[model samples]
Target: MAALALFGGIGLSEQKAKETLKNEALSGLLAQAIQQAQDICGSTLDKATGTLLYNAATRLKDQRRLGFLVNYIANKGVSSDLQLNASLDYIKNHPVDPIDTEDFERECGIGVVVTPEQIEEVVEATISKYRNQIMLDRYRFNMGLLMGEARNELKWADGKIIKNEVDLQVLNLLGPKTEADLEKKAKAPKQKAATETTEDKKESEVNGELHIAFERLVGAGSARGGESTNNVPPATATATAPPLMIPSVSLQPTQVSVPNFPADESKGFHTVPITSTIYIEQSDFREVTEKGYKRLTLEQSVGLRHAGYVISVQRVLRNKNGKLVELEATCRKSDMAEKPKAFIHWVSNPLMCELRLYERLFLHKSPEDPSEVPGGFLSDINPNSLVVLGDAMLDVSVRTAKPFDKFQFERVGYFSLDPDSTEQKLVFNRTVMLREDPGKI
Candidate 1:
């Protein structure tokens, strides 16, 4: 079942992987219950018996006595569906822990297959045997649920882990319960400290069964995930205690580092960094080669800013022609560590330039198909693949760049001054982008 349903595809995204893990854990719990029921019914298990046992334990919510019911019903004259229904109705209302096999057999007018001692043994083995494993499964299930809830409320960058303030509220709430549970038994609420971060306060407010269980496990330092319980001091009833943030969680999936550039793996355009210089050959453009020149869009200039390139626009006057245009400018190290948001390398004199951005070179046969081949694949080519940014403004620093000189366009792509560039006009052709720096191309 898992092979066909769980792994139908080749690769799984982080979210998809989490969902599969959650479903597996849930199925494991249910399967464990089925095995426990079958143990008491011996080697003659049937579909009807299995369905009844599953419904009684899960849907009816009778976790305590499913084993006894199985033993009493399966070893008797209750072979008919009518008799089975009557017996199940009786078991659902009665408490099985106190009933011995002799009484159960008498009530059903049939001798029990498993003895009373054997029933006791099965009960003990299945009920408390995998308590720890059950707790761990519950933890995984709850984490998956919380992540789904948080994702709806947060603005997450693609491929980034949940880290924003709103999502942190859900993460922090993974403690045993609400913040109130952190206090020692019978203790008054602790006073909030002036130094507490805003996050510390929010975690204390959300309440749920999962949060309470999480606190219990972490507080005892027995949680399977090794989450920290020492952050907040246990509350004492007799004295005033200091307020602290809820305990920290270290879910297994959360520990792995998020990839810098996550792409649609089904396609072939893997990420490659832009380190060297590239020269744009206008002759290489599909339009210039096959047709005529096309105008660039101003929206493309706005899109570049989102990719981490700080393009500055300043009013400047041309010395020779006295043309009025915004001096388009970019700093070489705008993406460097510890740079101010306002920092940019602006030039007094602006240059008339054009930037050509390229998308995937080969056409995909279908959205699901990954092959990008030669002749036939060209028919599936994306016409809007390349974006041209003409009528652009550039800073004076670009004047120093030769025709072949390459400059990494921060988060954008690698570009070189066009060979067709002259004193009157400048052009740049994009080579390849480093990564999928979100927002726009």
Candidate 2:
């Protein structure tokens, strides 16, 4: 019945029915065009964005029609003549580079330097978590980078680029495996197929040997100057394994240029790196002064806290001169158990310090108390929550500390060189207490 209505079965001919259907289709296309024009009526286009749209239109080969459409859009405030023209220029002038490469050649280029710590952490974590050939290969490359070798920025035939530094952080944070576990796994033999004949098994073994040889060739070629600086032992081969046959492959000297990496000057690439031994903040200090004693802000007491004057210090470990000589001893919990009695903290350098002592921010009252309402937590604000230790001691090293430099005081909490600190009078701000439970004696 619907088909008959469309064909007008009571009076319409076949030719007329076909003509009606064609007209309907044309009307639908026109409606869609109108909708598209309305949708793009009021949008601004930048050069890059305009170029993309213009290039797509150009592919349609309707140059005259496209020119009129561009003008109409520009006049409608959706685009501009300058932007469109720039895009047109870009489309005509942009260089086309080969995305896919068939080169079986190796290219060696200098990559970023990685720290020994970063390499150790990343390798340990990767070995434990993934333990695959691809990941292990990456770890080896990263190790080379740490040892001052330029890491190979491998560009696969399909255009995929493997950037070691980009993946280093994520791999480092993964839980690391023990060296014993890693060694055990490395020595483990690859399982063989149960149904395979001896001849097939021999072929598989030969293939495996060939793969190892191929890796060595690639690794050596990729290093440019010769063997990699990654001194770590091969994870796949056993110490006593017989030498395998090297596959016959022609060597070709070639260069593959990769995108230049962004500059990161803070990685100690061109500057001396400072390693922190300890960190003490205001929260770490016990009440050397009497509780509720007048707390003066460092700003308020800068004049009184003179050089060589004792502010407050406690003997943390066994030392006659009261100095932490061993860097590793600072991190040992066992060593902390042998700490000495409270001593005077002296100012070795001219320093203005604001020591903020921790106090209960709010007081809790019993539910049955007459004055206690549910929302009374705000009213119970501890007036002594912030005690400013204006007169504080600082070591001579504080002078060299740039603004915002964080370091641990001998017995205090982690403190930062305050932004307000100056060359004439260095200022230190107590950031936090050493312990989470500040009330603990």
Per-candidate local distance difference test: 0.32, 0.28
Evaluated at residue 192, the lDDT of candidate 2 is: 22
lDDT of 2 by residue, 150-254 (tens): 222221111111123223332332212223223424343332212101110111111111001000000000000111112221011000011111121121111
Candidate 1 on 316-413: residue-level lDDT in tens? 22335563222222222223322222211111123446767787643242523423221133223333357676654443335545675554342234
**Backbone clashes in each candidate structure, one number apiece?**
11, 11
| CA deviation > 4 Å runs, candidate 1 | 1-348, 363-375, 434-441
Badly placed stretches (over 4 Å) of model 2 are: 1-352, 358-360, 364-375, 437-441
Q: Candidate 2, 422: how far from true, in Å?
A: 2.7
Cα error, candidate 1, residue 384 (Å): 1.9
- What's every prediction's RMSD, in angstroms? 28.6, 33.1
RMSD of 1: 28.6
Lowest lDDT sum, 10 consecutive residues, model 2, at 214-223
